[model samples]
Target chain A: MGIIDGKTICQVALVVKDLDKTVEEYAKLFGVPKPEAFRVPEESVAHTQFKGAPSKTRARLAVFDLGQVVLEITEPDEEPSSWKDFLEKNGDGIHHIAFMTDDRDAAVKYFEKNDMPVRHYGEYEGGNYTVFDSKEKLGTFVQVKYEPKK
Target chain B: MGIIDGKTICQVALVVKDLDKTVEEYAKLFGVPKPEAFRVPEESVAHTQFKGAPSKTRARLAVFDLGQVVLEITEPDEEPSSWKDFLEKNGDGIHHIAFMTDDRDAAVKYFEKNDMPVRHYGEYEGGNYTVFDSKEKLGTFVQVKYEPKK
Candidate 1:
């Protein structure tokens, strides 16, 4: 269990108020090619993966080339959406740092013992994800997104 | 000037509440080692760094082995503290994500051209930092932390 528990951070998603406007600014400011954006009717967010979270997010996102790494900006479409909530409560800021893992069950169990519970569970396309409410653990949300062959 | 501009993500720091408790939870839950914690008298907060902000905040923090690409947890020790204001306004959550560069002035200029102004600025043991009120740029704070020697 402990052996398969190691996790890698796949992508860091920043919740924005407007994805289109933000994407344009990033492309201009960062010299990053405009990233394709998607809409997740389920999550009520439009996102784009960094050549990564593409279809899964259906998420409206803008990708920026940050050296070798890719920066993904995700904006939620719903009014009371998670992105909006984070912006309203915290004011536009860093939202969640996502970690990719192979053994998600083990990862979730590891955190569960520590008093941090899985606040949200999601599965999209070939991806399985769980957001550990970092509020109880630290002060952020630790998102464990995994690829599960179903 | 524009040719030297590079896109990079250096660090993302979070304002956490209890260092000891948060550290313990991180180690046990994510299989992340107990981070070395320290008090930054100048920064006015107790924090750590991430070796990998997504995989681990191997924090180069104030003291101990408390560094990792960390989920930094900061508490207020005094007023006029940026970490404190972040906590009070946002309630323990992800604060800001910083991108490092060789030239600070150039990076600030790049953002300013996009209508984002440098809001807060600071210097630390590691390097010099500037906060772009990306609220106008991308609805978040894009921090530029640069190493002068580079």
Candidate 2:
């Protein structure tokens, strides 16, 4: 038994240059009825960090619930964000693959043991998450997320 | 209704430099039991075409069934392959998004009407597929595929 798996993967986030444009583009391409776009308020993610430093990077976001997994399209602000870095270097493409971990500590330990280091750590709502700098070895970063307890 | 819906999308193909390495890395990261690698024979795709010409682009392929949609890892051969073009130009990342189409002809026409031209097309196992060159506007190629008739 392991921590992350196909079932544990919650979403695949993409870094795009234009949030609203891609949202419309996807809606038309996928023939979806109405795929709405929202914003991941930087204020809400007050505990944000970029490149291991305290920074307030914000993004306009949209989520498409593709049954088993969600597809997140993120358009980062002009701020120097990891998402912006990806969009500038790789253009609009996959940025990170995320897993919902019930136990964040165990997941972090496991990832470190596998030679994947957590580059940036942040908090959204009451939950904590870490971004693994796995792009070089895995071609994309890996994120492990936890939900705030009610 | 749109030609292809979000639900129609079956897989997101990634062009990697090393298939074996990526497969192993994913298996370990996702904590999967074991994900085996398979090679797509060049001759089998006799009808393959890249940039509007006959081609023999093969790849070491592996499918990670991520429940709702599958993640296809492809390492194109050194030959002049679209996959190779993507890898050479963009490095390892998402190459295209594929939707299983019911009618290949109509699907191709629909995409063409939307300004997304089919750049590569091929047939295998009695099924047909087309790759639309929508990377500029949409950030990635879109593929339409059909299954063999019963």
Candidate 3:
């Protein structure tokens, strides 16, 4: 049987308040090209695995070059977004660390089988993403996914 | 004058409810071995740093076998530890992602010059640390520091 292994965190997603300013700061600080910004309208919110239940969440996303890993920041328009909650409650910090996986289902299963608590926000054509609530286990949210790419 | 380059995330610290249990989980799930475990009771809290903080906030730590880096988990037996607050508010999420800097003062100055809001958590003998309030910048707190193990 093939063995299972935990992969290294390759990306961190930060929920920000303002998208344009955020991207601008990163570009200047890292001295890298400005990140291409995109808007995920309210309709796409349900499909993407975000915090809380499926609801309207307008998001502006940008990715900054960080060598091997990229820092992704998303500013949501509604409900203060999960990023705001984290910032206000705990102060600004690393939002979520993502580990790449070949098979998200298998990855989720592996963690579940190990008695890890897992929560799935939702799944869309892009991918089926789930959050391994590692807060109890690791003090971080580990996101895993395996599906078609956009 | 020698100019410093970019800052890179050096270490991620966490506060765990149980040191032994936390170490065991990572070792078993990630195939990483537990590094030597020790108690640093002299700290305001029962602590041990990833490699040992020269100032304070030293935490009980277990370095991953791969040496990808160290994971410092602090537990407070006396005063209310910052680690405890992290766990309570975020529920086992990333407490802080530390970015290594050649000149912590310079980085802070750069952000300050930009009118970016900052919360200086002060410095340790081992390194200087501060949380750049990036809620409007990156939607997360960027922890910057200058740490060199002696």
All DockQ scores: 0.34, 0.58, 0.30
Supply candidate 1's per-residue lDDT for A91. Answer: 53
Q: Candidate 3, residues B7-87: lDDT per residue as tens digits?
A: 365555666667788777766666655656754445433232321232344445555521333455555333344455455
Candidate 1 wrong stretches, greater than 4 Å:
A1-7, A41-59, A65-69, A79-88, B1-7, B41-73, B113-115
lDDT of 2 by residue, B1-150 (tens): 667766666777888888888888888767775577876555656577888878777667888987666888889887677898988998888888777877787888877887888788777666777899887667678888898679
Quality of candidate 1's docking, in CAPRI categories?
Answer: acceptable
Worst 10 residues of 2 chain B by lDDT: B38-47
Q: Tell me how many clashing residue pairs each candidate has.
A: 39, 0, 8
> Which candidate would rank higher by DockQ, 1 or 3?
1
lDDT tens digits by residue: candidate 2, A34-81: 567765556556577777677677677888866656788888887767
Candidate 3 segments exceeding 4 Å error: A1-7, A40-58, A77-93, A114-118, A121-128, A147-150, B1-7, B38-57, B65-72, B76-91, B111-138, B147-150
Candidate 1, residues B46-102, lDDT tens digits: the string is: 232211111111222421122223344555454345455566667766666666677
Selected candidate, larger lDDT, 1 vs 2: 2
> Interface RMSD values for the candidates, listed in order?
4.7, 1.9, 4.7
Scored against the true structure, residue B6 in model 1 reaches a CA lDDT of 36
Model 2: CA > 4 A from native: A126-128, B44-46
DockQ of 1: 0.34
Number of the top-ranking candidate, with lDDT as the measure? 2
Task: Put the candidates in DockQ order, highest first.
Answer: 2, 1, 3
Q: State candidate 2's TM-score.
A: 0.90
